[model samples]
Target: MDKSQLLERVIELVVDITGEDEVGEELDIDLFEEEILDSMAAIELLLAIEDAFGVSIAPTELEREEMNTINKIVARIAERL
Candidate 1:
């Protein structure tokens, strides 16, 4: 998928994990700093991303700082794709 599509899907997954529709409004916000994603939610997000994008993401393979925002997540997925 293209970047916009990837970003939208990532945002959707984040919304599902955080149960916060408002999160979609701020694509650049830090999920961890905002308390929208903790460790457990991050793992769940990784799994969801794998299922959605057909890309395997090992938790240990990525730094939280690299995947802490919707934009960052989209960038990472784009790289894998």
Candidate 2:
């Protein structure tokens, strides 16, 4: 998928995993700061991202700060893709 499509899918996964529709609409929001993504939810997100993009996200490979926002998550996935 292209970058836009990848980002949309990431957003969808975030919204689905977090059960927060606002996250899908706010691309730049800090998911952790907003309390939309806690530790458990983050694990779910990483798994979903892997399933969706076929990109493995080794937990130790990324710092929480590096993947705390939708934009950052998209960039990381795009890079892996």
Output the number of the TM-score-best candidate: 1
Which regions of candidate 2 are displaced past 4 Å?
Answer: none
Q: What local lDDT score does residue 27 receive in model 1, on the 0 to 100 scale? A: 86
The digit string of per-residue lDDT tens for model 2 on 1-81 reads 788888888888988897888886778878889899998998998899888889998778999889988999999998888
Listed per model in order, the count of residue pairs whose N, CA or C atoms clash below 3 Å is 0, 0
1-81 per-residue lDDT for model 1 (tens digits): 777888888888999988989888998899899999999999999899889999899999999999888899899999999
Go through the candidates in order and give each one's C-alpha lDDT.
Answer: 0.90, 0.88
Candidate 1 off by > 4 Å: none
- Model 2, TM vs. native: 0.94
TM-score of each: 0.95, 0.94
Query: Residue 26 lDDT in model 2?
Result: 78
